[model samples]
Target chain A: MAIAQAPPRERARPARAPRTPYVLIAPAVIAMLAFLVYPMASVVYYSLQHYNVSKPWDNAFAGLDNFRTLLFDDPLFWQSLAFSAKWVVTEVALQLVFGLALALIVNETFIGRAVSRALVFSPWAVSGVLTTGIWVLLYNPTTGVSRYLADLGLMNYGAAPLANPDTVFWAAVLAELWRGVPFFAILLLADLQTVSRDLYEAASVDGASRLRRFLHITLPHLKDAIILSTLLRAVWEFNNVDLLYTLTGGGPAHQTTTLPLYVATTAAQSHNFGYGSALTTAAFLILTFFSIAYLRLSKFGAR
Target chain B: MMTTQTTGRTLDRPALPEPVRLPRRRHRRRSAQRVARWQIYVPLGLYLLFTLVPFYWMLVFAVRPRGSDSLLPWPITLENFDTVWNGLGFGIFFQNSLMVGVASLIATTVIALSGGYALARYNFRGRQLFMIAMLCTQFIPGAMMLIPLFEIFRTLGLVNTLWSLVIAETVFQLPLSLILISGFIRNIPMELEEAAWVDGCSRLRGFFAVVLPMLRPALVAVGSFAFIHSWNNFLFALMFVSEQEKFTVPVGLAYTLGEFSVDFGALAAGGVVAALPVVLVFAVIQRYLVQGMSAGAVKG
Candidate 1:
């Protein structure tokens, strides 16, 4: 049938094509499917059923009930959602402000500049577990630096940092910031390096004050970097339940139970895979929204 | 921006004419330079204090006996180190952590090496989609995958095994490794491969013979990142691997605290043991890590 209407161009196309590239990538594709895609898809399936851990094979289909329960019924779920949002907002905001300030200050030449850069960026090299562990020790109410300070009449040890529900959120925030600020600083500094010296020189000649120059030139140039950094950090902070897991175990009556921890606690510890998977889906949906929103905003801003 | 005006010198200081405005530019410039210098020093000094003091205290507390109530007291003891080795399984935990880290590193790097090369060199139809898939995978929190992964392992009869930890870590590192390696491959000139092909080598051979050697910096960077990530991973190791003998350092150290409740010195010692490998690894390849981090931002 093709012979009657076949074009000369179609006849010129080669019958056999190259195969090495796909062959080279076959193992990788298999591994990714086995490890990345399979498990994720399995979770989605798990979310649809109520399976008892003790009786692995026996299960009943729950359909969308788990999702409904999480969205409408779980008060702890909503609490954690609020807590997660607050955590990301406060953490990202403070990191940006302080990190930008740090970049500006460290951008100049001075005594101990190398030493300072080393010190500031050094924290970035420390692993997250170590950072969380250090803070956990520091936040220990009975035997920590807080107690020492209180003994010296500097503050009240009775006001426990991680135990008090009111301050526990801030405590988690501080721990996250301690680890994340270096990331913000380095990114901003890298961006700041691209700003031409001539702009600053021109601004100086025009009698623009330092603050005015910063407001006009520095901030505007930093806009893209700031947004990107904030987005990247927001995703990280959203998913980072490890810090809370190590330091507080999401305790003080679950005051520090951010979304990820809540999901994990529900799924693994409580052995409710259906509810846990639903919460996981919920968190992923929120992150997907942020990602889409960022993409749209960036495109809009670029235009 | 400062403008200068030349002034004539006079014997015994001539009377100045209304403090020449242009000449003041030089003095103002100097003042601005002074302020800039101060601005730079303050933050650096503060950062130094913030980053190093905690580490110093970590070291200090690890060495000091539990009897020393003074927070700032300085004289060190070897007793904690002794107890860490004898009373606790720091040695065993360290070995397990090393095993898990190396296993995950090798597994992820192998998968990423091929995947990254394919993404870099090939013009496949699903390439962009694959890249986007990787980005999405990165955003899926490890917690989200934990239970399902546990169930899968349970069904496969792989729970409480080090291989389970390795598999979980390798999955997490694969995306990051691929991104870094792809960027690295793009930076390398394709002419080297072309030249190799002209010598009658197949595309696969050309890649191995020519491209692989040049990827050293990226390999060091990605390998270190994968290793450190695997080393420091605690939650999975905690929840998935329940056997004491199978425990990685972080989980093992956490368990030490509970088992040896008031043995603060031993617990501190275990913590110290756990932290040393990463510090040494970071110190050895810090420059590569920085390059990796900046590259990550570009790709992230």
Candidate 2:
């Protein structure tokens, strides 16, 4: 029934003018041009110059010099890039696993479904800084959960996860997972609701176990949604600088900085527009490359 | 509109039952469904603890007397709220945030509605290209855009103004909202608009009289999305607004967080302020979330 929503090509001889679409699209197009497109073009332009805000005299075209320094000499650049990869992989994988489980559980026709769904999905609304704020209170050594546990004779009191380089990654991961899982759960649940109950009914009659039914039927049905959401989540986790920036300040010694965090710190603090722009361009290219290959390898939407 | 398509009932039964014992088997399946209640609830209960504790912790810190380390909030004080609101300048920040959030909500929704109408209804030149361009923008890391966006805003003398935040938020919000809203407008059967036209309503009048009413859920979904995103936008607000008076909630929270001797009370209080509007918005529009998401999911 809903497939009837496809645009009716046969009704093309309409009373509407062709310009109506353009007119409707004008505001959006103009905004994107002025803000998104123009700024993007200028990022490429700035990457070629030495335009630090502190030194106007140094503002000259540097060609590939910025990229050269980034590729060859910058240890922090490579470190941050590697961390970004690790961060994205860990966040996306964990979020999907837990999120899928949560989505499946909530998809059942159980008691208190509405209220439970609302409670579980609540974290998706919390912003990154707010997330950091909440977790900071939880992770603050003296005033945090560990102190309580220690006072109850459960563990040592002075172990602050965010202050330690070894545990900081997982510390940030858990906090991010709180918010990230709900996004996948919501998307997967939407896709889950569309799976025809008759398919399950037929499988049940065929004496298929629940596990086999999920493997054979539900998995294939959710294939597209899973792929699409995971890809989007991967990119989002890569770009999200708010939580780490606020929580760790990208440090207890630069152990937690993602590439974008580096770019933001560079741009905001050191006023290194040219080098930051170069890093920005590199990150954009990497994302675009990774996305194209990921989509291609996954054979997304082909069915 | 979508709910009608999901529910199954006896009216859908064929002239002959698909299998002779189908009714009996369905009852067995219903009993089987009853068997898994604990499987659903026990783990859900644990996960809910994981989810709700952080929220509860924030509330506890925000209201508990400043030096009392009591686990459960009792004999709550308004001191933290007062500190962040009046003493810490969040009162000004909240006003700024609301102004930015609402302005961008209006801007993003109005522009997206029009652009979405085009994408949904009238196929035209460069339509596919436009859609592709919008999708590609998703991969452009927003954090990376700080340098160039700052440059553009500086050029326009808008670096410290709230308008810079509004414009940046609206632009980023546009791509997804446009696609989602277009997907929604597509799902509203064009026949409804055509029928209105046949009844002597002009196209615009037909849209207002018929289609717009049906679009309430989608509009709310899209509008609230814009509002939530704008409100939560941290980096742009932080980067653009250096003046404390111009700060949004996130920037204020970031400063509160950055201090070595962080005021847990004030930080938690500010966290509550940041969380309040979006949570309320989420609560209201969440019923439509699955439906709204499914439309976009089906499209792309």
Candidate 3:
């Protein structure tokens, strides 16, 4: 099932000409080069220069000054990086636990399983701003769930979770989890369906308890999927700007700003392309290193 | 020898006749069934609430009149929808989003199809490098690319145009779509195309005749993914297209969210407009989503 496995040599190969494959892939190759590669290269290049759209008179090559400033002078950099790490870990870990549970629960034979799965997974289709919109309506202090609950004598009258620094983190986390868990559930459920029923039956025949069967059979089988999904999700959560941007606007004194959000504000609002590029390069390095280390440490696909 | 024979006979006998052992096993089985039922229903019920509540809240706000405080959306009003669609310029945003989504879908699918075909069938030079490059692109943050991409679009005079968003969306989408489509192409055994070619059809003709039909599910999965992503994309549309008429659903919805005095009803209505197409597409393709992930992403 590994993608790196060589294509079967026995199948009669068509389109064997040297030029044909290149021709077929030209559009994709050209597009990536133009957009992805070129912009990435330019980001690194700009990181070394003093490029600000607002102040052309001061524009010049700054060498490592931007990085130096980011490494030393910028407290917000450290704060946002710390927040990004916290955000990724908490979000990914919670999403995995709940997602795995959701997948397992739905994997069971139940009535209305199809509709249940659809209803549960519907949030995965929602966009970040849309998620923000839905959650905003839910979190509004005057007219939202809090007020409704207050009407029922369940709790207080005003609970502005998004505005309060203490509750904003979890508030955002919950909104994200509403959409995030379904992704892991979908991927893990797909892999779950492929597990051999015979293995479970054998475990049962051996007088193994349900927990033991799950521990011995299902967990081992889902190892690769769990690793892959968590890694992808961690990266996604780290890079994701839309939900946090629209939901909180990195508010309450920059309590919710991720690194990428910081970069966006720097570039789009401040027009500080040079420093923004520096931040972008740092993020790229961190992500690349983290991904490599994760794959290595997890022993991905070792089984 | 007599004791062993008795034990063997007991083992061979149907458990139904062994009243002492039967009840215990049946009891355990029944309890296990009960536990399983509760385990499935209780958590699923709770999670369903968590999932559906926000959507229900949005629906409530969208339908309820502005001044009403009723929990239920009684005396339903289309006023919010009318307000956002007509007044807040979501109609134009909706049209723009549709244009970008459809264009991105077509562009991503067509390009990824060709590129995916190459990867699936042809073991060309740089194939491994190309695959690795595609994988590496996953880590490239779209938010990070805003500055350089803005510059590129400015250089090409594409800034503030829908084409800029279209191109940006297509480029961002190409890598994953290519990988997924290529994985799908590999799953369709190469023999099918060879069989078509054996009937005097050229490679292109063979692909159209034999392979194209079977790729419906894959194309649907990839195209809809592209469409949904493009439609939902905020930063690119935000940075690339600033014109009011060129605003996509996300950008427009973001503006509504960013307003000084928030309009809850209008915002929810706009949210509905933003959500409808993607949610409909998702429901139609929800069945294929897991299958697609297994075939194209996880297994690949």
lDDT of 1 by residue, A175-241 (tens): 7777788778877876676677778767867777778888999888877678777887888888876
User: Looking at candidate 2, what is the lDDT of residue A135?
Assistant: 94
lDDT of 3: 0.89
Task: Tell me the whole-model lDDT of each prediction, alpha carbons only.
Answer: 0.73, 0.87, 0.89
Q: Docking quality tier of candidate 2? A: medium
Q: Which digits, one per residue and each the tens of the lDDT, describe model 2 over residues A1-303? A: 122244454373255576787988999999999999998999999998898999888899999999999999999999999999999999999999999999999988877999999889989988999999999899989778899999999999798999888899899999999999999999999888888778877786676777888899888998888998999999999998999988888997899999999999999889989999999999999999999899899988777
Q: Who wins the DockQ comparison? A: 3
Interface Cα RMSD, each model: 8.6, 2.9, 2.3
DockQ for the candidate 2 complex? 0.51
User: In model 1, which residue pairs have backbone atoms overlapping below 3 Å?
Assistant: none
DockQ of model 1, rounded to 2 decimals: 0.31
State which docking tier applies to candidate 1.
Answer: acceptable
lDDT for B214 in candidate 1 is: 81
Superposition error at B171 for model 3 (Å): 1.0
Worst 10 residues of 1 chain B by lDDT: B3-12
Give the clashing residue pairs of candidate 3, or none.
Answer: none
